[model samples]
Target: MRIARWTVTDLIHDGFVIDDRVVEFPDGLTVADVLARGLSATGELYERVRDAAATPLADIRLLAPLVPAAVRDFVAFEEHVEGVSAGVEGKSDVAPEWYEAPTFYFTNPHTILGPDEPVSPPVTERLDFELELAAVIGAAPGVGQANLTAGDAASVIFGYTIMNDWSARDLQGREMKVRLGPAKGKDFGMSLGPWIVTADELAPYLDADGFLAVRAEVYVNDELVGEDLVSNMGWPFPELVAYASRNSCVVPGDVLGSGTVGNGGCLGELWGRNGSLTPPPLQTGDIVRMVVEGVGELVGAVGAHVAAPQLPRARTRTRARRR
Candidate 1:
């Protein structure tokens, strides 16, 4: 089932997409609500809404599928990491530690935008988009479940959605000099949706090796920019999820991003390959469209850049004398 949230005439609703129409869920029920009950309940919920009155998808405004409980984006594509590193840091080699385990960083969950929304990039000259697939976590067997094995982690995934991890490259480059953050560089905005396609709906696309062998593509201002297969990732979603739960807990509505795809997912990768910016960074009015087979398409428009105010410098002070 394809689940979505949308607004019509100032009223918001939750529904499931069937063909070109949306079947509204009962009042007060949402994708998050269903996910909170666990994936096993989805079959029954679908039966309840499968025959309801429907609305044409074109008549309503789509919203981000759900407000994520938390967002963890991983760098699971080796080519992407190498290309981005070469572009940003003048290095093309993948870090050795990257091969040891799946690594991820938390991104802001509050600023998520839905399809067709405008992204006002933070003061930046290098605004870029990351083509990624995000998995939404469903309820676990019990609250605070931790140390899940890869197989168990797979069961907790509810569905998949397209994501655009909007970035401010210049800002990211500056902050990482301190070895700390991709914070302001990344936290400004993120895009997810069209809708979420439940896991069962995508099972047919899974390869024998357990990778989702789906094609992902991205376009800028209607021009095709990049494409890759999800199976190309160095680590699959199950491993990523399992790593996320190592000594920690994953809750319903937690989103895990598959990071950027290789071969043109972003301008940085292109720069890395060509040794210069070819297509250039995103600008106001540019529309970014991302498609993941069996999932959905997510479209976002770049709005005018919002200039950030300068931060006051911290005063230098000598450490206190030893006690």
Candidate 2:
């Protein structure tokens, strides 16, 4: 079943999205309310609202299905790693160690936004977009955080959502060279939702070979520049989640992003590898649309900004090289 959080009549509410209609829950509140109640036992809650038709889709604003207790975005796509690493002009060969295991980072939960929300460009002047397919964790607690088998991984997945991880490319290039994970480059606003499809309901979308066949695409101002299939990833979600949970715990509503796909996933690609070649930079009013097959599209518009009158300047030179 597709679960959604929506706003209607100036009030936010929880609901099940079925056949393009929103069926509101009793005591109607946000989807986060249901998640805060612990999604593990919300079956009856969903049933209680399954047939309560309350609002029209056009009148409600959709929010991320879960207000995650924690959000962990994983670098689980090898092509993205290899291609991004190679595309950085002087850095053509990806290190041998990147293939060893799935790595991830914690992002700011407060910056989370919903579809159709406007994204304020950071001070850096080099904003980028990443199309990622994310999975929400179930409440099933695993034993000692051991390396989970494929089946074990499957059982722990609550649902799936499309994530657009907004990035500041210039800041990312400088920080990532240190070999530590991305920090300030990623903490900006991220857009998720429209609806979260539960694992059982999404089974058919899983390929016969066990891989999920989600496709990610990014369009800047109506021009398509990035496109890649989830099937192309080096590691599957099961392995990534299992590896991530090996020595730690993944709680309910935790989000794991599949990471950026190749060719146009970020502004670095448009910036000619290392800010060498001149490419178009996003200006005020530019629209960026990220779409994931089987999920939904996240559409955002860049807004205007005026430079501060007179600000103290900080040194901006660096020599660590791009990763």
| Alpha-carbon RMSD of each model | 1.4, 5.4
User: Candidate 2, clashing residue pairs?
Assistant: 13-29
User: What is the alpha-carbon lDDT of model 1 when measured against the actual structure?
Assistant: 0.90
Where model 1 places Cα greater than 4 Å from the true spot, the runs are none
Q: Using lDDT as the measure, which candidate wins?
A: 1
lDDT of 2 by residue, 1-323 (tens): 77887777667677788676788767755566555444556677777766775566777788767677788887766656655665464564456777787778889888888878777756766766777888887666562356677668877777788888887777778888888757777776788886787777667767767778777788888888788787666677777778777767666677888877665676555454554534466667888888878777878777664343565767787767895
Clashing pairs in 1: none
Candidate 2 stretches greater than 4 Å from native = 27-45, 87-89, 141-147, 178-181, 270-279, 305-323
Backbone atom clashes (below 3 Å) for every candidate: 0, 1
Tens digits of per-residue lDDT, candidate 1, 1-323, equal: 88899999989888788899888777578878988887678778788879888999889999999999999999889889888888877879898999999899999999999999999888888999999999999986633588888899888989999999999988999999999889999998999998989998899998988999999999998899999999999888988998999989889999999989998988889888788877899999999999999887899999998987788898997887975
Error of 2 at 138 (Å): 1.9
